[model samples]
Target: MTDIPRNPLIDQDVWTGRLFGGAEGSWYTAGETRDVTEPATGERLTNIGLARAADVARAAKAAAAAQPAWAALPPRDRAAIMRRAAAALERNLEHTAHYVARETGGIPAKAQLEVAEAATQLHIAAGLPLQPQGLVLPSTVGRTSYARRVPHGVVGVISPFNFPLILSMRSVAPALALGNAVVLKPDPQTPVSGGFLIARAFEEAGLPPGVLQVVPGDADAGAAVVEAPEVRMIAFTGSTAAGRKVGELAGRLLKKVSLELGGKNTLIVLDDADLDLAASNAAFGAFFHQGQICMATGRIVAHRKIAAELTRRLVEKATTLPIGDPASGTVAIGPLINARQLQNVDSIVRASVQAGAVLEAGGTYERLFYKPTVLSNVRPGMRAFDEEIFGPVAVVTPFDSDDEAVELANRTEYGLSCAVIGTSLNRATAIGDRLKCGLLHINGQTVADECVNPFGGRGDSGNGGSMGGPADAEEYTQWQWVTVKGAAERTPF
Candidate 1:
């Protein structure tokens, strides 16, 4: 295998100390450090800094101290910072794109798309303050009342490694626009690509010092932020097991929480559906980003009549995807994030074979590249069908009826996302509504997500973030009611 490129020392002049102490706008390296390896070739690309729980505490304290003044700023002024940050990101898109691709094992095209999406979210966030519509109730029984939206004190944003920039920015941009100071803790695996760049943007935007702090670390640091009493809300996106732990910590502290956890999502195709579109969507959803997405369509339920054809088409399309260096523009599939992920995916493939599942196509894990794998006759009881194989693996099953498909789709404890494809719009709609998932797409696999709509799970999949729609924004904030009574007509005790 070819050796990966070494970390360019372009930022050598940039300061390196504590990732948490950057409240003064001067960049600081994170406290603890770890080596980042190229997943495919197992070569060390660079050394990344990792923060500690102490760092998280310090960052939370900084955010708590700065939140009130930042919140007091006029809404439009806060939005102006978001717009400025978006502009800065646009200017540095190449740097952001390259690092994101290299650090996360995501293809260059996907990285560029994520960066663009994040910039768009920032633009949208920049517009929120101008559109804060509150209810003005008419005078009732000789009294007038109105509702007001206000920012929460401090918000803790914890994100995962996959799609680091877009997912992390989705929460941070909105929170900052809403006038809340933020403590952002990105996954250690892609710390610089995910967190440092965000910190730099905030500084370039001229945001008030301490309004945003980047602290990179592992689950321990994440737990610190979730358990911090000063944090008004914990916004988290990660695995179900880890999310549950964070949620419990937040609950114990009585803080509001947003949890975007794991998913074993399913894609359903009826006999009457357009086989071409269904096959393409399923193939991309299952193999794109090496199936690292939280909402990847891992389980495919095709109509019995069309199962054979759909599987054939899916295999044909999936195998054609190119797996290579993530920085290469031509690469469609990329390596798994790390060795552990590759091993985990391989174990599942082995277990599925042992359980009598038929491997339709590639099922080999060579280094970090797990061949674009397709499995057929995956029994419901098999590990491949029951658990989340977060690699380029798709398990296909056949359903004779819509009811049976829905039942199979909902069988797993997760209810994150599902896509239904059928020729009859009414039939697809009925099944889409019936499926137990947070986000449902009819006639398509899970497409790229937008911050405008609520994107999360329904069941054990986990609670969602509060920055999507108006209701979601309200969910993140607290309401203070006011009553103005006539001086002369005050209530007589």
Candidate 2:
């Protein structure tokens, strides 16, 4: 806030140069620093410490040191603390959401939606502490046997820039609720709303210092988390290529891992589908938060009979969504997260248009503000169809039959979410059955998530892991088999 102009919304105390290592959420100022940028204006937001491996090691050490006592707390007691954490997050929603909007260049509405969802994650996790954590097993040897769920001790989390708060909390809150201490490394792009704000919430809620670490850092810090011997598991949300690296490194260390990666999601419009319903879902799915969501519909496969009308409708809607800076609190869509993302979106659009996809509505940008675009006659091989363009672009490809629609949808390496829109529930259900995605919607859109429901992806989209109370119970803990015999049973050697 000294040289960099203080934003009226973003609190200066949260954006300072101090880095909060996981060691009880204490400030660590010994490191090289980098500037956080406001994507809309290409201006410096604030300087933050650039964390190296040593910083992560310190956090891991703290988590490992603090985990046992946290785990020793009564289950109901832990639940009480989790509820307090959720309340703390709720009280600070508006204040932290301002940081999310400015830092990610997302509309205020979108930022608030994610912030509210993040708090919901904590609330849902608050119920996990009292759930039965072990199963009674049958023993053939006349000995009582049991399988008990135990904390992995320390968990390392690496969250992505897009949808930062919820993604990080989806892992962090549950791990804490289930008694595993966590060291969270939020994406360097959105450290405050993603990392610092979460740390502040938990600290205010009286979570033991060192139980949840917030380290805003780069790849070196993430790698250190995975490599630390004291850290028993890794929960990462990022790109597929990056997920692969995290998986490989964690595998070599024989550690537990959960990865939520990229998506090239689709929505199918049957001949029987209402054109208005299909077009509305397609536009919202493709352009919400500038299509930065992992569940954003990248392709719309419509019946040949209704494809033209659907495309026309999408084009009409696309031109009407306001596009500009979110700080103004007026636009539906805001700037891309950064210059590189802007370039990537533009390149894919240009290449797809050159390959013969009709640029029906939008294909231009002013600075980082890429217009909500709709394309028709898109094919499987085109860049728009093949790559995950995490931008506000929608592509429509016509399918002659249900079989062909299923074929077109399953062709991608990513199988995250799919929507089948038709009046007939039976018909939609059949088509949804043939699709290879982890999440399916019938007579609905692909962009949806509820904290209580098991949500995840398959193949490149994720490692078949989910985020919910039940899924969290499985992912955050390890099972130990215990057997007991009267008077010390003897075994022949």
Candidate 3:
């Protein structure tokens, strides 16, 4: 690899590796490599080695072979390693946060939050070893039985670009803690930042090789990892369309799959709710990370009495957000990942305008920086109202009552997350329950929090994977029931 910058983070002599067992601290480099560019400016950030299909297969094979040894280790021992890794991450908090911000265009404060969250997830996963709970099936049909959770052998993780480090950690930590070997396929855009940091920490903590492997490449490389027979389970987090493709391949291989896909999440505001707080939080949730999050509040449904007031407050808040370089502490907004995402956001906003939505503020696009935009009077047939824009754009619509608001919220096919704002706790809780989403927030905006429980979406948003609690550890595993009926009693028929 050629050196473009003298930054300490960039590794010269570009090398990739199969981070599975028996190959402790081994470097595997493909002859081909490419340059990674920063979104804000077209400067070269780093040079990354692109792993091919063959490299993916080899990584999977290594993980598969290492599974038995990893699973055989005592749960406490495994937990100790994970806890050490978390400690290591905590020590290097500054560098980790800075690297994520520089590469992913995330602001310093937000990036710092994600780094801490990643560490907390590791800490939570560390607790999994001591909390293995199983159900007793006392004498079912003349046989005493019980159900136990077991590792699913070699599992594959396909992560997304937005919130790369935290989201990947959310999946990887639990899988590894549950005693399963993991082959992590990081998003190509922000690959070096997340996986590289994790690998370094794991090595420093003396984690067993092959327990966690990271391969950085494009879709072809990801597909190779998913299609491998050695990979028994696939945990994917990305767009709904891409999730479908990965699901299809996993289905052909009869592999277990967990998907957390796209969403057009809604922030419902009632007439009697706190308009100022809701507007401020809604602005942050809708535009944070350039509105690329799966659970971002892309659609805002407001009660008619307060719709105009909330819209006015939201537009005012969006206008004042300081947009600048991601590294600057004062800058709250950052550039989009690349040109494609910027253009996609632009196209969707244009369509929303054509469908009767009125622009509230900020529609200028200069390079990767698309101004934080808000639209009013958005109707059903527009792409912005229903589709995952994946950019800094929000579509606002008004509803008559709670029933009509719930109906409008569920109008889209995606069901990842939603938020309700109201003065009455009982009414808000009741509305939250009726809303069709994996996670519902009352009087507060949604965020990917480690302490809070995580649930995957239904419908096109994808389903069946969680990252926080004891149940998260169970999801990464399979089950095996063994019955020892007094050594079979040598029963002869």
By lDDT, who's the top model here? 2
lDDT of 2 by residue, 1-493 (tens): 2233233324556547766655555666746778888887777877777678988888889888888999999988888887887787677677667668888889999888988898888888888888898999988777899999999999999998889988899999999999999889999998876787777777667787678877778888889989999999999999999999999999999998998889999899999988988899999999999999899999999999999999999999999999987877899999989889999999999999999999998899999999999989999999999999999999999999999999999999998999999998999999999999989999888898888878889999989988775688889998999998876767796
Model 3: per-residue lDDT, tens digit, 95-147? Answer: 77876787889888888887788888888888887785566767745567888
Clashing pairs in 2: 22-213, 24-210
Clashes of each: 1, 2, 4
Of models 1 and 3, which has the larger lDDT? 1
Candidates sorted on TM-score, descending = 2, 3, 1
Each candidate structure's TM-score, on Cα atoms with residue i matched to residue i, is 0.93, 0.96, 0.94
Higher-lDDT candidate among 1 and 2?
A: 2
TM-score of 3: 0.94
Off by over 4 Å in 3: 1-22, 140-144, 490-493
**CA lDDT of 110 in candidate 2?**
89
Predicted candidate 1 versus true structure: per-residue lDDT over 352-383, tens digit per residue:
99899888888986678889999998879999
